[model samples]
Every structure is written in C-alpha cells, then in structure tokens.
Target: MAKPNLPVFNSPEEQFQQLRKLIIERIIVLMDSNFSSLINLLYRADVDEFKLKKALAENPDNPAEIIADAYIQRQLQKIETRKKYRK
Candidate 1:
C-alpha cells in the first residue's frame, strides 16, 4: 500500500498562518449567511435595496452600523406607507 502524501508546515508560524486562514474563511461564510438573512428581512419590510447597499459601502467595516441602517430604513418605509394611506 502507498502512503498518502500530506504537506507539512516547517515552523510554528507556518502552522499558525494556516489555522488563521481557515478561521477567517469560516467567519466570512457565517457573515455572508447572516447578511443574506438581513437583506431578505429588509426587502420584505419594503426597505430600499439600493439604500441598504449604499449603507453597507459607507460602513464597510461595521456590521452593526449596516444593521442599524437596515432597521432605520424599515422604519422610514413604514412611516412613508402610513402617510400615503392617510391622504
């Protein structure tokens, strides 16, 4: 039987780098899933998709800020609908 070959890291730093990369990739996947859910909620609430995308770009590094923007947008949409029907 032939032994399977696996690449070996030569130093602690190299192993750490590999582990860190894996962790970051997993985090990114989780973030994507959460963001998708947020977007869907915003859409169902009648929030503008363009505005949400702009907010995300404006706060590229802050997920909380993006979420706040989504919530605010939903509120604004609700207010607008109320005003429209009150006429």
Candidate 2:
C-alpha cells in the first residue's frame, strides 16, 4: 500500500506574514467601501485609538498598512495576556 502524504505546515513567520498580508488587503477594501465598519471593527478589537490615529496621521499614504499593523499588534498583545493569565 502507498503511504499518504501529510499536509505541509507553514513556519510561524510565514504564517504570520500571510495573515498580515490578508489583513492589509481586507483593510484596503474596507477603507475604500465601508470605512465606518472598519472603525467599528478596530474599536471592537480594542486597538489603541490614539496610536491608530497617530499612525494614520503620520502615514496618510498607507492607512491600510498602519491599521493592519495595529490590529496584529493588538491581537498579539491579547494572546500574550491570555497565556500569562491562564496559569
């Protein structure tokens, strides 16, 4: 009998980059079509409003990239908090 091939997994860094790219793409779409919804999402996600505003002001040419980065950082912070408190 032939052995079945196992699915290959991406490295953590690669996985993270893929996710980041997807998020940036989505953010760009939302920015163009439904900005209020994007704001609601960021609010619900608990990304720092002040930092996000500052980033947007500083990098007005790439708001999607800034928003994606803030969202990713906020998620990472939440994960770390959960792990730290799970004990």
Candidate 3:
C-alpha cells in the first residue's frame, strides 16, 4: 500500500480561504439561527476572522473541510500580551 495524498494548503492564507467556505457551507446546512448558536452546535469549526470573512463572501459550498472553532480559539489566544476586546 502507498501513502495517501492528503490535501495540504500552500500557506496560511490558502487555509483561511478554504476554511471560510467550509464555515459558511456548514452554517447554511444548519440554517444557522444565530452566530453564537451556530458556533455552539458545530461539531467542529476552524473559525478565524479571515475564514469567517471568506465564508460569508463566497458560495461556501466550494470548500469541504471545516476546522473546529476550538482551533481558532487557541490560535487567537497565543500571544505575548493581552489585547483589549472591542465593545
């Protein structure tokens, strides 16, 4: 047997673009009532600001891989200093 060819994005940008489509596709599938509720019900979502933007921008059905929100949360948390949240 040979190794499978897993889809590997060229860079973070590519991943974000793809992620966005996935998020929106999932959202549509769920007929998401609200953003928070959608987030809560998602089995897993790679929710990044860029991805969210892209998802909301495109048809969303183009991409098929949706990374969990947990991943995005972790990425947003890794920093040397804290940042202020917008109100």
Candidate 4:
C-alpha cells in the first residue's frame, strides 16, 4: 500500500477558500436530495443577486434597481452566513 499525497498551497487563505467551496458543493448536493426547490431558488437568487451588483456598479444612476439589488444581496448574504455558520 502507498500513501497518497496532496498538493501544498503557498497561501493558507486560498486553500481555505478551495476547501470551503468543496464543502458548499457537498451541502448543495445534500440539500438537493431533499429540498430541491430550495436549492434551485437559491441558485437563481445568487445569479440575480450577482447581476444586480454588477448593474449597480456599471450604472449608479439607476436608483430603483440599485435599491432592489441591495436588498436582495443583503438578504442573500444573511441567508448564506447563517447557513455556513450553522454547519
């Protein structure tokens, strides 16, 4: 039997992020096994949230959309923070 080896990263923070992403994927898979709608809605909400942020950055004059986007982004942040911390 041979021992397996993993690559080392110069930056621990970057390594942490890569590991975090893998964990999040495992979580989404688990969620899909049960609450599929929740998973889908979360995915769509994230995409919309990102688009809104980009729009706000690209067009600061759009007050209405900016406000809506800020609200959605905040809500998503809260949800994600809660979910991540709970795990």
Best model number under lDDT? 2
What are the root-mean-square deviations of the candidates from the true structure over C-alphas? 16.1, 7.2, 9.5, 11.5
- Candidate 2 on 1-87: residue-level lDDT in tens? 233333445687776777778789888888899999999999999999999999989889988899999999999999999999999
Stretches off by above 4 angstroms in model 3 are 1-6, 32-87
User: Using alpha carbons, what is the TM-score of model 2?
Assistant: 0.85
Number of colliding residue pairs in model 2: 0
Off by over 4 Å in 4: 1-60
Ranking by TM-score: 2, 1, 3, 4
- Candidate 4 to truth, TM: 0.32
| Model 4 steric clash total | 0
TM-score of each: 0.45, 0.85, 0.35, 0.32
lDDT against the true structure, per candidate, is 0.62, 0.87, 0.52, 0.56
Ten consecutive residues with minimal summed lDDT in candidate 1?
20-29
Give the C-alpha miss distance for residue 24 in model 2, angstroms: 0.5
Which of candidates 1 and 4 is the stronger one according to lDDT?
1
**What is the lDDT, from 0 to 100, of the residue 25 in candidate 2?**
85
Give the better candidate number (1 or 2) by lDDT.
2
How does candidate 1 fare on TM-score?
Answer: 0.45
Q: Candidate 4 at residue 13, lDDT?
A: 76
Give the TM-score (vs. native) of candidate 3.
0.35
Candidate 1 residues 20-43, lDDT tens each? Answer: 455344435446767676556556
Model 3 lDDT tens row, 1-87? 233344689998887767665654665555544566665554343346576557646644533333344344545664322454431
Give the lDDT ranking, best first: 2, 1, 4, 3
